[model samples]
Target chain A: MEGVLSGAIGVLAASGIWLVLRPRTFQVIVGLCLLSYAVNLFIFATGRLVLGAPPIMPRGGFIDPTAYADPLPQALVLTAIVISFATTALFLVVLIASRGLTGTDHVDAQEREP
Target chain B: MTPGPEHLIIAPILIPFFAGALMLIYDERQRSAKLAISLGAVMAMLLVGVELLMRSKGSALTGFNDIGFYLLGDRGAPFGIVLVIDRLSAMMLVLTALLALPALIYAAAGWHRQGQHFHSLFQFLLMGLNGAFLTGDLFNLFVFFEVLLAASYGLLLHGGGQLRVRGGLHYIAINLTGSLLFLVGVSMVYAASGTLNMAHLSLMVPMLPEPQRVMLHAGAAIMGLAFLIKAGIWPLSFWLPTAYMAGAAPVAAMFAIMTKVGVYVLLRLALLIFGAGAGASAGFGAEVLIAGGMATVVFGFLGVLASQGLGRMAAHLVLVSSGTVLAATGFVLAGGPVQILAAALFYLLSSTLATSALFLLIEPMGREEGGIAALLALTADAYGLDEREENRQPEVGLAIPGSLTVLGICFAACLIVLAGLPPLSGFIGKLGLLQALVASGSATGPMAWIFVAILILSGFATLTGLVRVGIQTFWASDGAPPRVLALELAPVVGLIGLLVFLTIKADVTLGYMNDTADALLRPSIYAQGVLGAPRAEDASP
Candidate 1:
């Protein structure tokens, strides 16, 4: 479980960082989204791998101690996800607006204008 | 002490949030409704700020529904997402309210003409500003930061001008990048420390292993960069002047407070988390901060020197002020408790006042009669302002009280304050920080002094630029004096009154600043304020 989590996190980080380094605005936005996913997963996995367990215990019987996962990180991840989503939406609109207004998606395009 | 109701902190944040939403349903042209709602929101914020300030001891509000949500410190703790209003935060809220009130009033005068939902956007912006200052949790802090930025995004492009829109895009892009960095940094910190609560992290941080310690510091540096960008520090500060120059005066004034909040957060985190003696190599820390601050100061001054318009110059000054505070932070980091505390407190107060005044002044000075073009032409004709500066934006006569003299005086006073000249809190704050840096035996002592020298020089440059501009507009012989409308003069006068107030009660103000400084240096009060008393024999939370 740790291996899978670490591998996915690594890929996410590498892809996000690579995109972020690009000059395109769309790429940067994509980078941010990827990074956000990696961060969210990283934070969740910090509670340790609990693949078969539900965060909330079943009501029918007293739950096994190791069967339930920590819910705090999940709650936090939920908030982070919502905030990131809003952020991405804002970026998309801004990207479209700027592209329409300035006629460029390349971050350097504005700087290069005489 | 018994926990106060947890809702007090939440009140300041929620009032404007809900009010802003309610504003959207009303007609865009309903000026009266917008004004009343805005007035009510600011008034609520003012009351909450006042309530929080009057208390000597800290209070918290927490609910015990499984996971606790707490608001504690100062007077009473209201339940919900805790809003701890310490002496420092309370004072900031008050200052924010003072600035926002007139800016809002000024916005109302221009709302219809500007063709934006000024009131609704303004309300949400205020909500974000208030929430940013009030939140006890780190994640919530980012939430408020985004809220503020979102509102600013709308407000900046309210007029739909091409230049304004382009400038707004740049501003949004930089801040959005900063926001992502902030998120990454905070989550990394949380993962490393095992707690997201600031108070808990402060305690847990010192015990972390070496590599993790370095990573945490790296996280802090990243977070610092985010705020610094928001604060408009040099290198990352190129977006400020053009962006601000393109905005409506009232919007500019309100946005001025936003940068200060960025510096405020940086200061808060620095003192509370990183500066808690939990990190290795104090020299490295001080050097990094001071150096960044120094570069910021230099660039800001250069920007001021090259600036053509009142708005751009003011934006440059904002950069200088942010840098000044950051530079001063280095000294505060190295200096003894008394010195660090005093300087930090004074810098915060002085910067907030100076920046807000500049914002208020832009409306009157940028108008056609009072506009930078007229001011420049008049100044150039009188003192030979470089005629090569032809690409300047045109200024129109202000819709408000358009007195160039009042505007000149207000702008000059702000310049003086920003430059840390005598008879203003800026001078006192700078003096305190200088005294401390000189006393602290850090290796950066020479560099600190050099930064101080640059600060002084930048102050003079900005002052000269302001005077030159003012002279052209208000004092030039052949220049037609820009007419000052009454509406415009009100904000100018109100800001001046506050400046006078700061001068008159300088000692009391410094005393309060001193207490705030002391509280910052001694993180225990903050720790206790945020986290409930440690259980049993555990020293660290």
Candidate 2:
């Protein structure tokens, strides 16, 4: 499960990097979204996969200290998701402003020197 | 009695957010009210900050528990968010306030005339910068960073000149990438360690596996990259001088404080999370930092040599200073507690003083530019005044206290101090750093020698260029170019006064720095302070 998840994360990262390098403004935004997703997944996988459960600690049941999944990563991911959302919104607003002001969506629209 | 320091930590972030919200409705044209509101908030922050520092210094900040929305709370009360006011963080908050006050004052002086909603954005930026410093949780740090960046976007583009717009775009683009990675890194740390509580992460970081550990390192590296881009370390620093050059002097000064926030976080992570086995061996990003810092210093010197006048030269010098601090901290990290702490503290104090002075200097330098240019132009029209006046512009306009040469000399002396010359705080910092490096026993081989060579070379280069600037501007006989005005002298005097203050209190300040360092080296104290002493069950193997 870890391998597959991290593999998917790798693909997301590559695609994100490629898109980020593109000249289009929208592409950069898309790239940022993709990279964020990849990063979140990568972090999630680092908790050492627990097949039987999400990190909720079972009570009144056998307390297998080893079996209890770590809840910290989940908590961290939740916050990361929210931050990424805000960042995306910020990017959208800035992208629109740049377009309105410069009349171009290309990243290098303002570049003059070769 | 009063709620503990942990709760007070929230005020630094919360007060500004509340005040900034209030400022949004503030009349766009009511410059005075905006100034009052911002200044009022800053003073309040300073007061609260000093209180927190005093409290935290005495003992643990004590974490938060159940207090929902009130500005203050306890450190151990673990629910919504915990704000820990450790010595390291407390010091950073004080530094931020110091930089913020002047930058705001500079802005108040008429910089806003060229921009819109200046106070609103400035307030928001303050909120972000403060929040980043005070946050005890990793995710919250990311949130504050975004807040700060969002505010910066507005300020960077506030004036809307073509050059500014271009620089703003690049600045925003690079940081957005950084933000994305920052999110990822925090998430990874959470996954590996199962906690975003910085203190908890400190305990868990050393226990992770190889592949997982490497991934964590990568996350840290990526996060470091974001900060590096922000801090204006060499290679990644390309955007800094350009963006800074385009902004008004006051805005640039405020932004100078922004990069140090990145450096602060970088230092925090290196000391707290990445100091051990896999993390240390992975080199997470220390080598890059060390190399980049040296490069930044070299690049800054070269830029200064190649540049024409004061403003641009000062901008490049800031980049150099940023690198010097980063490099010094990197070297400091290689040594043990006592030496590293002393060195880091000294360097931080001197760096802040030098950087602050340079920022203030820009305002006068800008004024002088016009005066000096006009003088030279007049001399050309005169055909042949005194040869000195003909060859160099003389004091033409105002009655400056010293010759442009003397003023230039003072500025050069300041830079020499910045580059770590003896008898000044800069030298003390550099000397302490060298001693730490040597004592670390890590300085004997090739890497150490290379690092030393870079330090010495960068030092000499900075001195040579700065002295040359002094000679050209002040020493060279120029027909009296322009008498300096009070406005020009005021900021320079203020900066010099700060330098003098640092010099006089050097022993006391260095003592405090050492104390702070000792506190930082023992992560256990920080952990105990932020998180209630670990449970006996948790300690069980």
Candidate 3:
């Protein structure tokens, strides 16, 4: 499970970086989304990849720490997701604005000569 | 649990927040009301900031060593988000408020009305700046950074044009990437240490084993990269001049302080978590910071010389200021005297104020005629003038308009300050920095000498560039004096006036800055203040 999760994050990040480096604004926007997803998963994995464990403690009991997953990473991941989502939307709007204003979808807002 | 003076620490963040939300309800036509509310909110924040500054300074006077900690939701520190107000944070809050007032006033002239939701976005930007200065949690700092960046994006695109759109696109994309790096760095730190509170992290960082320490260092370096991007260090700062030049005048003026936010965080964290106290990790990135900072200063100087427009010149000056402070921070972290840090703080204050005034002055100065055409004509006039014509009129009094005279004086003051010439705050700041750098005896290594050389060289370059621009704008041009309004002129004059005040009161301000620097260098008080504060419920009888 750890191997799979780490590998998934690595792949996502790699592809995201590739797309983000592309010239098209659309590619950059999509790349940002993928990068954010990879980051979100990476943040989630910080809790040590526990399975079948509650994130909360039972009341009035001597709790074994390993019986529960760390909840802070979960909370952090949620916040990251929301922030990244909003920022991606903002990036898309800016992409469209740039495209309309400059008559190009290139990240530089200029087209290459054929 | 009753409210006390300590509660005022949170007011800086709350005032603008509520004001922003309130202004959102008003439509675009209700400009006057929104303006009034925005102005009121900024004034309130300034008052709160001053109050906090006084309290923090007073605590130092009484030798109490009390750093005000405002725990959210009555929770204890390290477990919940916290706002800690030390002398440094308090001073930053006040500086932000001071800069915001003039920018807000200048924006109200016509810039704010150029786009929708201007007032609300301005307020939100203030909230973010104040929050970032006051927050004690690492994650909370990131949140506030996003808040400010989001608001800044709106403001940058406020007066939408092709230039602004293009510039804003790059700015947003770069900052978005910086934000992602910030998240990754922050999460890695949290994972390694199991804590995100700055004080808690400071404690845990020193005790981490070899592997964890390496991870922590990597995370810190990554985070530093994020800040360096915002602070406009050399290579990372390629987008700054364009983006800033593309924004409306007041927006650019407000951005003068934005770079300082990065410097502030670097100084704060470098001293707090990785100070001499942090075993094995002490002075982790100091060398890199010094090298980068010096290179940035050189780059900024070159940029200043190359820039044709006053707006771009002001943006480059921002980079120069950031570089100087960052380099000085490296000096302090590398075991130089705390007085060097004090000098850097003073430089930070003076340079930020001067650059902001310069930005505000650019629009009014350029209001005479067609922008590029007029500039081209001025250049031709300067270069193509006949020798007999130049010698024709006596070098004495020509009938200069009163408005032009006022603008000229303000422009001269900015020139003097940015160039670090005598009789202004900038010279005093540089003098202090140079003095401290030289006086630090054994610590005056090659890096210190390099920093000193760069500082002096950058100042010279700035002087030449600004003088050329000023001559062309004021003397060579034959256009009518720009119709400067009182509202617009007030902010520029006010900022220049404050710079003058900073010069006259240099000793007192330097004394306060020294004290603030002292507090920063010693992290024990900060750690105790944040972690030792009792929760409200616990404090209650």
How do the residues B1-541 of candidate 3 rate in per-residue lDDT, one tens digit apiece? Answer: 4688778889998999999999899877788899899999989999998888887876535464458889998788989999999899988998998999999888876666556788899999999999999999999999999999999999888766677788999999999999999999998888788899998888887899999898889889999999999999998999999999988888999999999999999999999989989999998899988889999999999999998888889999999999999999988888999999999999999999999999999987887655423333333332242322433333222323488889999999999999999999999999999999888867848888878888999999999999998999899989878666678888999999999999999999999999889888888878987899898788777
> In every candidate, how many clashes are there?
34, 26, 0
The TM-score leader among the candidates is 3
Q: Which 10-residue window of candidate 1 chain A scores lowest in summed lDDT?
A: A105-114
Off by over 4 Å in 3: B60-64, B371-401
Q: Scored by CA lDDT, what does every candidate get?
A: 0.71, 0.68, 0.88
Better-scoring candidate (TM-score), 1 or 2? 1
Docking class of 3: medium
Which digits, one per residue and each the tens of the lDDT, describe model 1 over residues B89-153? Answer: 77778878888887876665543335546777888888898888877768779889988888888
TM-score on alpha carbons, each prediction: 0.85, 0.81, 0.95
* DockQ pick, better of 1 and 2: 1
Q: Rank the candidates by DockQ, best first.
A: 3, 1, 2
Displacement of residue B138 (Cα, Å) in model 2 is 1.3
- Supply the DockQ value of model 1: 0.37
Q: B112, model 1: CA deviation in Å?
A: 5.5
> How far off is each candidate at the interface, as Cα RMSD in Å?
2.4, 2.4, 0.7
Model number with the top lDDT: 3
Model 2 chain B: ten consecutive residues of lowest lDDT: B63-72
